[model samples]
Target chain A: MPIIQINLVEGRDDKVVSECVREVARTVSRTLDAPLASVRVMVNVIKPQFFAVGDVTKAESAAQKDKS
Target chain B: MPIIQINLVEGRDDKVVSECVREVARTVSRTLDAPLASVRVMVNVIKPQFFAVGDVTKAESAAQKDKS
Candidate 1:
């Protein structure tokens, strides 16, 4: 079996997480010809300061507030 | 809170996966000053053919057999 792990800042609703997992999994499954049953997805949440986006932590979600 | 997503090929022993999670968590916790409890880790495994390493899939594990 193949598993995929994705870690991102928390706070996203279950819908968002579920959508992401489905999208990535679907893409990979189609591209690799792997069955959906064989694909596994897992998520990890970390503190904003613990992750860096372009060398900057998501803790600066405030700064990015206006960007997205 | 922040979450990071890492997607890679499956088949790694639990020890390797455990070490990876622990190391990444430890590093991020220390660097960002987050407590270990705040860090959540999840793993997903993708079929070798589903994942690309430097533009190549891990399915070529045989070709890479002699490399590592």
Candidate 2:
């Protein structure tokens, strides 16, 4: 059995989340040659502060001027 | 930053899920030597019919007599 999970920022509505879940599940089933019934998908929506890149939370980075 | 997602059967109460998430995040943070703030966890609760082993869905197999 294959279980897939996607992590992204929170904002999408129910419709968008549902569509994303379906697409992810379909892709996993197709790529692994597994039965559609055997694939499970979980979507994790996180607040911007909970995720970071390069020692700076995405929320903090977004607030500051472009460092590059 | 590390994101962890766990896939398991549904029916767990909110408390169980929260504790699971915290433990997972803690382990990931410690093992990776990453900041605790940088770890994110997502729990995916799936239906029995959606996960299978040996080409048979768990739900179906459970309904039948033990084959072993």
Candidate 3:
């Protein structure tokens, strides 16, 4: 069984989310030679405030960029 | 950096969810001897309709259980 977990920033369109899920499942299935039906894909969307890099959140980064 | 992804069924109390995230990060840090600040824990809450086992969604399983 191939389980794929995807982490994405929140606020994407529903169509984009569904397409990403489908594409990921298809790619994983083909690459791993696993049955498409047996593959499980889960997507986790994180708020910008909750996602961070180098201790600075994405929300904070965006705000900083707006100031400069 | 130790990044931990946790998959959970949706509808838990917000307090419980926060506690779980804190506890998991602490446990992973302790067990792996990684710095607490370096451990990242992401929790993915899945709707019952989106989660399945043996091709039966959790929502369907609960409905069947109710009938039985």
DockQ of all candidates, in order?
A: 0.15, 0.06, 0.11
Error of 3 at A11 (Å): 1.9
- Provide backbone clash counts, one per model: 16, 0, 0
DockQ of 2: 0.06
lDDT values for all models: 0.61, 0.72, 0.78
Provide the lDDT at A7 for model 2: 81
TM-score of chain B taken alone, candidate 3: 0.88
- Model 2 spans > 4 angstroms off: A1-12, A15-68, B65-68
CAPRI category for model 2:
incorrect
Over A1-68, each residue of candidate 1 has an lDDT whose tens digit, in order, gives 44666666766677776766666555545544568777676767777777775777777765688688
**Which residue pairs clash in candidate 2?**
none
**What's the residue-level lDDT of B59 in candidate 3?**
62
- Residue B44, model 2, lDDT: 58
Query: What does candidate 3's lDDT look like per residue over B1-68, in tens digits?
Result: 99987898677898999899999999999999999999999887886655544344556678899999
Ranking by DockQ: 1, 3, 2
Expressed as tens digits, the lDDT of each residue in B1-68 for candidate 2 is: 78665777755675556556667777778888998887766555677789888888878887785654
Range of the 10 consecutive residues with the lowest summed lDDT in candidate 1 chain B:
B1-10
Residue pairs that clash (backbone atoms under 3 angstroms), model 3: none
lDDT of 2: 0.72
Q: Rank the candidates by TM-score, best first.
A: 3, 2, 1
